[model samples]
Target chain A: MTIHHQSATQLTRIICAGDISAYEVTTASLEQIQAENPNLNAAITICAEKAQAAAKRLDESIGRGEIPGPLAGVPIVVKDNLCTEGVETTAGSHILRGHIPPFTATAVARLVNAGAIIVAKSNLDEFAMGSSTEHSAFGATKNPWDHTRVPGGSSGGSAAAVAAGWAPISLGSDTGGSIRQPASLCGVYGLKPTWGRVSRFGLIAFASSLDQVGPFARTAQDLAAALQVMAGHDPHDATSTAYATDALNTALEKDIRGQRIGICPEWMSGNGLSTGVADTVSHAIEVFEKMGAKIVEVTLPKTQEALAAYYVLAPAEASSNLARFDGVRFGVRNEANTLPEMYKSTRGTQFGDEVIRRILLGTFVLSDGYREAYYRQAQRVRGQITHEFESAFADCDLIASPTSPVIAPLIGAQTDPLAMYRMDEFTIGANLAGLPALSIPCGYSDSMPVGLQLIAPKFREERLLSIAAAYERHAGQPGVAS
Target chain B: MPDITSDDVHRLAELARLTVDSARVETLAAELSDITEYVQVLRSVTCTVTPSPHAMSSVRKDEVNPSLDREELLNAAPHSDADGFIVPRVVG
Candidate 1:
């Protein structure tokens, strides 16, 4: 069962039935990412000779007959903030340490044109601000179930390289709750989508309207086949969403009877949840009320002003999309001698300290007497949290909640900064209302992992990945990391 | 709700060109005044809704594409060569 514990839809159906050979499952996923990325440091650029030369050219174009696609040779990873053309991509920041990216990242070029293979480059938090990836400057990733916790993060190295099996699927991004809070602290199945349902061109910018990029599987049909090969529309991401996406592996054999499913009740009687994540989201809403859905409850009533309007509209759009890392165009420049000391000594020694405290609280909420008191009252409390998720999806069809209200702390537990921005109180109201959520893993507390989020609306995402593949087939799998 | 001093972290590290280390400007003026007093709860939440902005604009077809490769982005800049990228001397 190796090949890094199967799943990219079971290694693209046994490498399209040749019984195995996408170069022997990309050489057993580059030998389980070189024996589990040094005990789960969940990758930071280990493209083993460009993923064994793209799995030996998808095993010589499937022995000269072709036909593969739909993620053929599988293997994956991504998330060093997308753009991967010659790799380096450091969004986990050191002012783009040894830059590189001369392109590629229309969702990692639609998962390497649907035949996967990337193989490495995870780590995040620096430019993705933080929720722990211990604000990565290329370090903290742990939590392959618990190496003193913290795998939850700005896509904590693509959810600890898909819960340590070293990639069955990966890609990461999601602005607030960087990929479902590190795929709910590395248990797996993350999602996010919907915002512009996937295309963010090269992805680097932090809060470009609460980013998107998605995927991080461990099931739910390899997160709906890596969201049907990284969802659609591109023309280099002019906020994508031109449409035609739904084909989530043919809505994973539908089944959410009588649907409904809302929940919320001020997110399960609030107060920063955690009673084993509100009894594992009330046993995943009583296993979706024993598979006939309905649940109800609702009332998003401005889900507590979505973590204070996503910390003032994602640090006022990450200080205007990181005023393009000045140090003369790209990265590493610092020698200074005016030009504003080379943009303050190359982003003050290649940013960190929570990206220079969110670019000085996003240049003090877009300065000039605090733009109508903090970025237009956090864009009118982000249009009342997108009209309370459009009036709770006008009476529910998907909501759930509790992606992270607790669990996975340990790794230097909360070193303030508003206690690490309340570790994105239950995933920043679906990235401040752009919607389509997901997460999954629902169960386990002191023994970590909990997640269960869901969400939906806006580009429905094939009914949010067929209700997370019918609650991941009645909450079974989710364990891995051995 | 004022507080973040050290001259507002030296005018927000001089409008975020960012360089603040006077021993971390009194701990970034006490963590930017505890995150601007916790995002002043979005200025007491009285939203009369209007903000829209969620980016779904599209537009294309203004022609002229194929760009990128000015000598491989001027050999990834940091003070490039061949008539480009070496900034600093803003006109005499």
Candidate 2:
């Protein structure tokens, strides 16, 4: 297998034109991923055989004179947390090191059915627990732009794989900032749909209230295309909305004419965003303004309180969701003298430091004496924030902000846990409010990429994608972007 | 004073279903006190007694859905045979 670099759409065009076979593209993508992944550490697991077989099937379909799908012969990567039948879905944890799903996740299976080849499973913070890929039990995925720095996580591997040309597009989950943060750092387009926009059935739960599966790609068009095929209401996941998936490519055709944009007070305050990030976001807003969009100053008053509420809420939900990992069921186990010992041994031995820390904090807040005072109070604040967002949208069509408060922090410079947790301040509120948001690379921080975020009301994904896809042509992130 | 004791650590660990080595219990107890103190920030937040982060209610259905087959559910065990998940037997 000789490795080469080509976009997913480009590969499909090639196969459509009979320039190459799907098998050739899959083999080349795997070979290229293998060659670069050792340095990138983006791929948590590679499934070359399954990918090749799938490609063979696509080729067979084409040979039979049947019309191929839009993503036919295109190879893609997926985050490790989404289940793939017969393939290990470790979620970057030691406990599920060899755990394979009997059935594929609804979203992933739908992607396969749409004819996109699943090439690899990307690394993440174990259980999507941290902003940095450093928390991944398997090891950190490095920024392809500069290998010494992180690829921003827990979808770091997915973003890095796309940015590094290991894959043209990838699937990721955002609980808080997992998908967008990493996409920002890796210089790609990542979108987390409104809380219920995408199906979450096959995904291993993290913070259940905040978790949303999304797509990552080099171009906003690719992200939109991948999302169209991957999103929809699954009767299995009650939270999924009933909207028909938006044809992401249509917005690029409609043009972003008269699109109204807002640069919120939370985004403009340089205190939170780095100088480079702030400057680039401002420049992007300027570009949008020149392109006939109105920019306004909007306030998200509850944003400051989001970090605290998320800290309490995410951990609380995670603690409950993760309780299912007890050794008596599956995963790693240690002999316990009692039934309680089974729970003790599984989480104690299997969970990484961050996961344990979150669980501890979660349990503390949800405990009897503190339940009303802590968890209940945090929920109240979250409600207020959601209301604030609904009101903010009344003033602006779409809210724009810098994705993270700052550029990617140095790999191990984090000595304070609270400071590390604050990294998701700008991005988490969208998740908290169950709103759809996209992070597209607007500029760079030194040599690394930075993202500008656009958020829209729930079910207005087409508008959000149209606004984002318009900016796709004039500028593309350099060095690291796929 | 909310200075948690080793007894408190043992209890909270049990509530959390976590295993803490004897050597770490004393340290954890000390850390828990400081954390509990830090967590007092939540008390300062005033609200209308209405719980904030509303639970996603639509997740549950009133209709009782069929559970996964007992055989398949048990088969998900790491170490399973025809009848059950084989764990270290605990006998009093």
Candidate 3:
């Protein structure tokens, strides 16, 4: 069997059944990463020795008559932003190039505890800043489907790694559609849980309130398996929710019959939406209807404002969160005669254009005289957007939309920053409302994947996964680009 | 639409503690202006959005927690001595 192509859930079952050693699975995953990484640029740091050591440990444990953990021996990649103890965690920026995290993120630690092997660290936009991985100081990750096109980001590398078959599952962080947009462009399943569903102990923060670590996988069931391990509270993160995550895997078995799927006309027919996307979504809605689900038109009139609000609010938060990287404590430092000069030159040279642009914009908005006009007003609009979602959810069990307005653009097709920001329009609403949302491949558009996104109210991951699982079972899994 | 002047750009950069190269200042000014203009749409919107109770109010109880040892943390620092992180003199 092609072990690397198997889903993480299936690989675990196979490994536990003694059909394959965990070491063999890890080897195959490592080999795949080595083979595909040059063309895809999906992984920024490959951990062959560490992965082999981990796999050997798991295999020995299973040989000792021990019951394998939930994900036993599944090879996974994590976005560069997530800290891994003893391994370099760059967050795809030059500032932290050689900085090895002393501790691991709670989400990655939980996955490791569940018996998953970490094989590599995937690439992303610098500090998870942009819609495309082009913002990475390393280099942009190319779309596996079309080399000229980009793998959507800032979780672009995680999604691309899964699509390229380097690993069956990987982790990504979504502050504003980082996970889902990339997952859509790559033809995989990505889930952004309720804001506090997954702990953010060591995730390099871009926007604290909106950022949540999520899983990207080839199948919804595999995504559910990952979430089973990742979701829960941590003493380290006060924002981590204590919500019960039991029965999430079991919830995948439920059907979507009698469920109300909301379709917002404003979102579906919004500007920038291509005919290919609209047609693909229309067909997906029909699939749900055929399965005895009801489709209803719901209103979220404030949907358009979400994009603007996210930009303001996210940058405002980022400006504060990123102040820690000043040359003194950790990471790269440039020499200067004075401490303040050291800070200015170190940051000025290390941060990428997009990161600096955001920092400056954030400073401008949060500046003394302009706070009311920009930051405060954006916060109010964020509340209104959240309220719009809550009101819409009252009439529907789940809201459905295209994960992105259009297919993945060519790698350099979107040089203008505002144009790139528009790519996340369809997916940012969930972030604003702090809702759980899933993006699964609906169909192909221009040969690229078109994602049908299903969003549920806060803490309703079970609903999102169940619906996604039902759709995947019927439609069959989307094919990866060769 | 708000025009972001070169002065505004420099002031914002100073506040952010980020040095904007003179060569890139003009481009940054234009880009910042575009973004600011785009976000200005929110100014016309009026809605009552209360702060989320859980988001604003939730805090873990102050408690003892296991933390990374000092050596491991110091190892990642740019400059450190036996005492602690070494930096340029703070006292002028």
Candidate 4:
């Protein structure tokens, strides 16, 4: 296989065995990105010189007889939201156009420490507020499978980067369905780890509680390898869990035989679920059944309500989290005579329409006379949804559903804000419950990819990975878009 | 849920420190109203459970760790100097 087409694990093995230099792999990845990025728009900032330097350093270490890290010599893409020291991390927003972070995100740093070379900073929705990359100020990322279609967002560019063979693995942040939905649309494996599984130290905050950094890869093994490095505790982020993550890659070797996978009927037949996606998910379940896995019909009545609660809760947190971007600190500043005028002018003119809409919604929900009815009620509903997931897990090891309700839509297909919000109907439940969820290609619909979403209880990423690996083995790896 | 009027949008913009353009106020109002109305489905949900926040874990002991270089941070600011970040004067 060509260097860019190989998975992270394979590339690492090849580089470590002295068959090829890390510099060679990094060069191939940079070449592919430069050639395809113009058409795909998957990458916002390509770091060719930096990546080449990092890869050369790794090759020199190997030449000096130093053992390579697990992800040695692998090329990776990171969503622009995750800060990279000295790199202008725009987070797909015009406000942050020239802002260079002083520190790298913990997850990105971990990947680099493990010898993964970052090829580029991929695009995302503005502050991860929208479900499509169309919200990006840098311009929308086209799906690799079909250029006219969107590669979902706010991590669309990361997902498309992997699917288009620009990189073996990429990092993306999931707040609602940002990671999984885009992973689905791009026909790659994307995981939204249990909320605190990965640190959020330098990730540009959209919703502090809901945002999580995870990986997108063409293979489950690549996802496992990426997550193994990205997971664990960090003192910088108090919310990061101290749980053990050593079992992730090892668990992928185990089969899914005798595992009980839960199927939520409400989600299976949920509103707006396209018939094509439904068939693809059903077929995926049947494949699991054939692989000696038991399929249980589980009821999660509150799962439907998670979408409603997530919109309120995520935006509410966004309004507060985004308050830090005033003209004083960093990023673009629209100078005005007064402090208040500057704050208004900088935020009002810089933030995109979706961001403005979300800020307004968040402000409205938290406003006087509306807090108790909207924000507080949404929190209560969030609690109920969490409780529902906890109860559902008692009956099954993992819950399976369609990752996205529909295939990738045309770039300008969805105009209504509400219609765009509904794209996350199935994937929002996992984020609401703070559980580990993965989306892997199950089949094709309308000649585009459909993702089968498997959600496991908190800190059970191993189960999600192992089951996804097993399914990938049986279903065969998804084809890379030519 | 009542429709979010342009007046409501203006009020929200003021509170959020966002300037709503006169040309976009009507469109913004309609969009916000649609989202709010759609999310009103949460109102029908009978949520008796107390809202539990995400549990905090592994909070490190309070210690003075080496902080980022002030010069680097200052350099990233739009207006900064040897002292600290500079902002528009708020008080007379």
Candidate of highest DockQ? 4
Query: Taking chain A of candidate 2, what TM-score results?
Result: 0.96
Q: Candidate 2: global Cα-lDDT?
A: 0.80
lDDT of 4 by residue, A63-176 (tens): 999989999999999999999999999989988888999999999999999999999999889998888899999999999999999999889999999999989899999999
Q: lDDT per residue, candidate 3, A1-482, as tens digits?
A: 47778888889998999999999999999998898888789899999999999999999999998988899999999999999998999999999989999899999999999999999999999999998899998899999988899999999999998988888889999999999999999999999999989999999999998999999998888899899899988877888887888758678889789999999887888588999999998899999999889999999745558989999989999999999999878899998888888888999999999999999988888888889888888878888888888999899999999999899999888988998999888888899888999998899988889898999988989998888888988999766667
Determine the iRMS, in angstroms, of model 2: 3.3
The residue-level lDDT of candidate 4 at A245 comes to 84
Report the Cα lDDT for candidate 3: 0.89
Rate residue A135 of model 1 by lDDT: 83
* Model 3 Cα lDDT, one tens digit per residue, B2-88: 699999988888888778899999999999889888887787888876745346326766788776898878878999987899888
Candidate 3: interface RMSD in Å?
Answer: 1.8
Error of 3 at A339 (Å): 0.7
Full ranking by lDDT: 4, 3, 1, 2
Between candidates 2 and 4, the one scoring higher on TM-score is 4
Instruction: State which docking tier applies to candidate 3.
Output: medium
Summarize candidate 1's per-residue lDDT along A1-482 as a digit string, tens digits.
Answer: 66657788778888888888887777787787788788677677888888888888888898898898988888888888888887788888888788897888888887788898888888877877887788888888788887888887888888888887777788888878888977887778888888887788888888888888888888888788777777777787778766676566678789879989888777775667778888877888898889898888878855456887788778878877888897787778787667887898788778888888887888888888878988888877877878878888999888887888888888887888787688677788888788888888887887878888888888887787777788778767786865
Worst 10 residues of 1 chain A by lDDT: A300-309
Over A348-464, each residue of candidate 2 has an lDDT whose tens digit, in order, gives 878887777677778877888878877887788777778778888888889898887677777887745566776787898898889999998888778778888898888778877
Name the regions of candidate 4 deviating beyond 4 angstroms. none
Between prediction 2 and prediction 3, the one with superior TM-score is 3
Write the residue-wise lDDT of candidate 2 on B3-81 in tens digits: 7678876776677898767786786666656555555565565554343443342656578887557775566677778
Docking class of 1: acceptable
